[model samples]
Target: MIILPQSIAHVQQLIQPGENYYLVGGAVRDALLNKCNNDLDIICPGGTQKIARRLADQTSGAFYILDKERNTSRVIINESNGDRIVFDFTQLRGGSLEADLRERDFTINAMAVNLTDPVHVIDPLKGGRDLLEKWLRPCSGSSFRDDPLRVIRAIRYSVALDLKMESSTIQELKETVVNLDQISKERKRDEFFKILGRGKTSVSVQLLHSFGILPFLGIENLTNFAKVLQRLRVLDSFMSYLGNDSSLLKRDYFQLASFISGLGKQRKNLSNYLAQPNNSYRTRKDLDHLGAFLWDTSHVDECEVFKKLALSNDESTHLYILLKNRNWLHEFVENGGVLDNRIIFQYFKRLGDAGLDLALLTLADTASVVTAELNHDLWLLELEVCGRLIETWFEHPEVVDPKMLLSGTDLLIEFGLTPGPLIGQLLENLREEQAAGEVLTRQEALDWVEEKKLK
Candidate 1:
């Protein structure tokens, strides 16, 4: 049932008689599995850049030289619907194509299909059989030793594709797990985020934990492992239903199901909130899982841990605020406090947009502690606090982010004051006043600041 993708056929027509070009790696494997793969990997023995440039010109795609040392180039064809088709052209390693396939990381990724003759596959490592058998195997004995990052990729591919690693592969991964620290933080971070980007985050993370990969990433000592698993499940379910996809919800997760269903119409708001991208490849949902994973009932230096993972400052800051205030909303509800515009304003004031993510995280944390008996009243209280806060964030935008009624210059000029910390403090207080519905106009804002200065 091997069906070549349309992109492959398109490239086949452009192939000249003498060109020694072949489609290799995941693109070939995905084609054999009848999957839709937009990223294609093509190998050229000597003239990778020339072939890449020619393909880019023929297809009217943008071109970039990815690695000059290895002679790797990329062609990106931007589709009308905002999707991109990527073709990576790399210089084939080893002397011949079979040697090149043998040098790859895994059997499943070592297959190739010549562009000139697109019908037959060149699986030198019996990758086609492994694909049929629904198991993972290394292309060679030294696969993991060559690049320890493959250890993480092995777990990711297993969980993502529902394939089991062979017994010997598992043994080798455990032996070389320590060497993962030698890989660059950026590379490890990239592969880890790819795992997060795929769904079933809890399953993937547990596998990483079992395979002893989380320690190197600085997230191994997660407090209360069982409860952490529950929190992850609840968080994943929230991301799913809120993002308008309910397939991730499981039947055993009654509390999560009920909690999400209780959000009612605010589900759409949370969906849009969680859909915000941290970068080109990551979204707020990914951060939610990271928060759930690193969250400790006690305390841990989350910023330092994120630094160890080489996460971007923006991501680290968001997760820091998330874990720091993980219990704020829950304690508020437990202490019999009701949510209002003023409280909501202060919450967002402290956490900014992360306040919404915190609300979801708190909800998941709260749901994880409850049992099957399900205290109806307690669940209701937590839901009301979380739902109303989320509702205000999306329904009443002015409450979370109020328009500035007065500027710093207005304070310095109108009040005849120096531009010190007082001006900044007064401006911040003015925003709180605006959110509280106390200052409605520029004149009112000015008078409010004047009145505050006198105090």
Candidate 2:
């Protein structure tokens, strides 16, 4: 009964009459909710892979089998707007469509609709009513026991759809919380990232902590749990302060959420927890910096914690610079040092592209410590100052990079200096002079380098 014109058209083109297939799961729930969800789950009595292949071939999309034993396959249709529509085709889990619905995680997602007759929804469990009521009810009493990962999914769906958990479902979740340990880390990590990806993660974290799931995830200390919550709050507030600015959008806020979630939790190593294979070098660098921020140890470069985390050389260098410069800037701000053009430029130059992220992180950390009653004005002033600096940096990005006037090779060839560490030192001095506006042109830069050599 939903008006998904394009999706319905696609479905009609792919599915013929008499085909034993139905649109199922979240797709149906979202349709009833009047939400446009491109990720559709379809159930078929058989020929799941055939249907997937046909759909992919017809749409010029890509096809892959998600699970061979379960007869599940996927077809991804790339849209003009750069969005992807994923159609997951799977055979019925049990004997019939009704039975398959019974085995679903939540009542709202347990409904189905015939692919041929899209107007009439098949709600075997009155899931449509639960959707109307905005309540999340398990399809069966043993739902959590059926899959402990459903417990996490319940929280995620609750926050995502803005639904409330039924009282009975809440009790069932509490009773079956211990079974989460039986689930694989990969599944748990996937669900956890989904929750973080939705943003507004503090409530979910609090719910997990209250449900005794944090302990299973390695967070046992109550004090550290409070710190984690504080960090999330700070992050939320800082993101709000950024408003419509899109510069921070390129950074993975989901990873930030994940990092904040594990800040207080004890873990074996950062690499094992992240488990993001095939990540770009920038992503790894960002993760390493985030890990260092969470570790919060003195001498981050030499910290045993980082050593055991198994970061790459580039990741380690980025983390070291981020931590060292962040600490310096934080101390400067705490000591009431003036945030003039010179100081801001110095911090930005030292931090490079990570300067803004570090500034936001510093503000969040400061906000986490400031009490409502004491030094509240100081906290507000600090936030304003940081915001201004970030805005100014974005408006005038030349301060950050400052068009390097001289390279190390240039220093060697122009100054007739031998290939040694002193060339690097001279280039560093030249960059500092350029950033400080002492040397504006190439000639001035050469003069400055020559003058430094005389010194």
* Candidate 1 total steric clashes: 0
Residue-level error in angstroms, candidate 2, position 260: 23
lDDT of 2 at 211: 88
Where does candidate 1 stray beyond 4 Å?
A: 1-17, 53-64, 75-78, 264-269, 297-299, 412-418
Task: Write down the lDDT that model 2 would get.
Answer: 0.66
Q: Which residue window of length 10 is worst by lDDT in model 2? A: 264-273
lDDT tens digits, residues 270-343, model 2? 22223333232123323432432353545555554333334456555656666666566566656787776566
Which residues of candidate 2, in runs, are more than 4 Å off? 5-8, 53-62, 162-168, 197-200, 222-231, 237-330, 340-353, 368-374
Give all candidates' CA lDDT scores: 0.81, 0.66
In terms of lDDT, which candidate is strongest? 1
